[model samples]
Target: MPATAPSASSAALPTLLRLRDETFDPANPGAYNLYLLASPGRLCLAVADVERRKFVALEEYQLTTGGVPALAEQHDFLSLRGWNAVRLAVTGRAFTLLPSPLFRAGDELAALRLHHTPTPTETVRHTTHPGLELVNVFAADAALADWLTATYGATGRMLHHTSALLAGIVNQRGAASPRRLYLNPGPQELTLVVLGQHLEYCNVFACTTAEDVVYYTILVMQELGLDPEQDEVTVWGELMPDSAVFSLLRTYIRNVRFGFRPGNVQYSYRLNDVFEYRYFDLLSLHFA
Candidate 1:
């Protein structure tokens, strides 16, 4: 999980979750913006009414066979191309962030290589985070990127998955709270972000055990000179309060807590049943 990908491009794929507000206008595609988030694990889409500043629809799906082609086949609004704006984010890819002042236009590949080696089929892209003063450079599926551009015929907002996560976290943290830690955990990995005077650290770690989670958490705290006993850690995921991850975090860190959905926009009552911590990355695309 980007678990932003938490299966198939197939029409037969199960719709894991679908929440729509009565205000959502499937008949008027041009009035709403569409957000598509993809990872090897899953594909999720969200719709927001531009003028109203509210999320009207949220859907999650499994990705498997292919990409993009399914859009033309969807019986729903996803098949439409008249959206006011479309933002696509690819998760579970190789990405690295560099401060804008230190980043030069032509060095996206170099900056990414320092952290990850992209496969031959991947392509390099970069998006600026002016609010955070950082440049997110990442590798996305080459064919998927190409299909999206050719189909849309416009260069819109395309970014790393972490950009959306960072925007949501930064928006949730305020001026008075100078230090914070946020965690987004999936079945096999964790995306951790730490904020000091500014963004102090943000990275995803591959983990297969409860020990891995605690180890990385402590490692980050240790590196940033943060106190596990004092600083607060908020988590956004489907974990139960007594789940192994939470239990270990509370035991070791002493100040861990579950996070809530981003407060930057409004959500439909239909989404109220969906846990606030779930679909966070998909919902945070509103900030993107």
Candidate 2:
């Protein structure tokens, strides 16, 4: 049974941007895998038909504010629009990792509860990545979780944005820099992940300007002992070619370059006109 997409006449919100392949078919929902990414004030989604090896549609919505309430609203909107079985990757900054050996199922919330000073209103949840041998603990608003459970029966697979980003980066096999730094920038946040023989550092920073981007990138490099002139800095996410952030990064980092979509997955020609680096996390969910 194929799922159906909402009609184009569906009510419109304050969308930041929306792109769709001409071949996108609401009648052939079974042909695509849907991926949804929610951040503090933004939501990015992509639908890829792996059987056909192409992306059918993608959207980036700008929320007035991001948090539990915002996520609930966006999630509901998608659900009402007939999108189902959503794989949610949260981009909020409330995640911590634990080794698999140290993780226990009943106490996922307690494992990293101290790390996140969740208010009485928030709830903590945990997801384990056996492949990475790491446990991810994150927080969501209690009300949001309840609403989702009541609305959809349960919160299907939920992943931290960090997990999605790292999975996307590790899944890229071609450009293996022994000691490389990968950045995924968003509205007011920049996620930095360092990779070597193993994962070195992963953290997010709050920034909204070109200078802040450069400052944080260089600061992390210095602390990690990566040379601006020597090591590679690969970036992905929502910046334009002529954008201030891209321009500043190139000026300071010698080996910097934009990242491409994961090599393992096949992209349809519908995505030929779209830049490879954009919607990285959303598209990478095919592997996630």
Candidate 3:
């Protein structure tokens, strides 16, 4: 759809969460980095002060419908540019990671084909993590990729959500940290990542019940020879400490805890009310 004014529904897009620091200046977009997270169910925008390394703004919209083309039409800031930098993280399970030594730029489709069937309207995108010596190859919505190009052009790049999650794992994991599991729970789905010195396993699970999430967590742990009674599991996103998912997760595993915001960056006092562990993927976009 061509760019146009926000519709009545678009203007009222439920703002699930919104925080703007006292220092944030919408007029001075050129001074900050804008990070956008787009998925079928959620759309998020975060702004970081490049000079201070502080996150000055955050806006999350819970979407019952819509896609990339709706983004600029729904939010004026996205249509405007002059951002110091921008990176949009596309969320989906149609992604895979290969070691740098085995990956080639032109082979994204073939690599992703093993795990996901890319649709005709999707475009292949890759982000190489030199520190981890791995390349994440994933498929992004073709319209979303094209829209980013038309709006930001050379000013931005696209990344897979796993890239940000992995970046968070690496940045937060200590040198002496034991083999640990990370769970990022989302609406009707769960993502599990295991870290053993290096990334050992990562996968997304389609789930509907609390039982499904806990069952898969334990199964993956046992399959990987991780003892549920002794191993550590950290969780972030979509669940409260009192939620059924967390309750059941604790029953199966001994070491269970929530995640925290990235320690490297400062945040507005306004964001303190938000759960620390929430939006790990969005906050970690800075690391990706």
Candidate 4:
């Protein structure tokens, strides 16, 4: 049977987690920071807490490509007849991970699964605090030129998945939507950062090498209508602590005499500090 969208009362909120490389390592004992992306059907029930850290328990289910039994048969460890809330990391297609009210407290520690009907599509996943809406943007006519002009504006471009996700989050939060978005596939890859609403100007440039940072920084300044030599620009993203990309981007801006600040970006309500929280906050928000 095709899965129907859940009612308001039963809808699942979205959740976002900014995962650091260390968090993925089993050797690390510290609990990883996680934000609830869009809202979920159930609230988390705390089982333990220590040293300002939370150890909460909630029902969790895994969805696969087939029906529940078929999924169970393929995975021997999964319990086909009961419910389970096991720590999990989901990978692969995002659309397959639809919200469902199939889990409940007191159900046994068994695997439960569901599936979505087949359809031709492209998957765009944006991680934010739980409960934030998920928006998917695709080339309307399958032409980069048309997509760019329609979503961001002339000379606008999209170079990273993070920018697109940010645009979607802002629009979902009632912010202005961009008219055109641009993307280029080349060594001198260019990504245009644009504020959807009518702003003073548009930023442009190509990050060919570390030295190209100054050129890019100047472009951003020109777009914001700020004096590159006098004003400062706030930049945020997930890059290695000591990465060539980060150094290049930072040095380029610094040399231009613009005030440069480094910080993590958040896209949800539960954001606190540091890590770039991208997914929807599920604990407090809901999807229509």
Q: Number of the top candidate by TM-score?
A: 3
RMSD of 1: 4.6
Q: Which candidate should be chosen as best, given lDDT against the real structure?
A: 3
Question: Which regions of candidate 2 deviate over 4 angstroms?
Answer: 1-11, 64-77, 80-85, 147-155, 174-177
Each model's TM-score, in the order given?
0.90, 0.84, 0.93, 0.29
Indicate whether candidate 1 or candidate 4 has the larger TM-score.
1
| TM-score-best of 1 and 2 | 1
Q: Report every candidate's CA lDDT.
A: 0.79, 0.74, 0.85, 0.28
Compute the lDDT of residue 74 as modeled in candidate 4.
38
Pairs with steric clashes in candidate 3: none
Instruction: Score candidate 3 by lDDT.
Output: 0.85
Flag the better candidate by lDDT, 3 or 4.
3
Distance from true location, Cα of 260 in model 4, Å = 14
Runs of candidate 4 exceeding 4 Å displacement: 1-137, 140-190, 194-208, 212-214, 252-288
In model 1, which residue pairs have backbone atoms overlapping below 3 Å? 3-6, 7-62, 7-63, 7-64, 8-62, 8-63, 8-64, 9-64
Cα deviation at 82, candidate 2, in Å, is 8.7
Summarize candidate 4's per-residue lDDT along 174-220 as a digit string, tens digits: 34443322211112433333333432222224455645654655565
Using TM-score as the measure, name the better of candidate 2 and candidate 3. Answer: 3
Error of 2 at 284 (Å): 1.5
Better of 1 and 3 by TM-score: 3
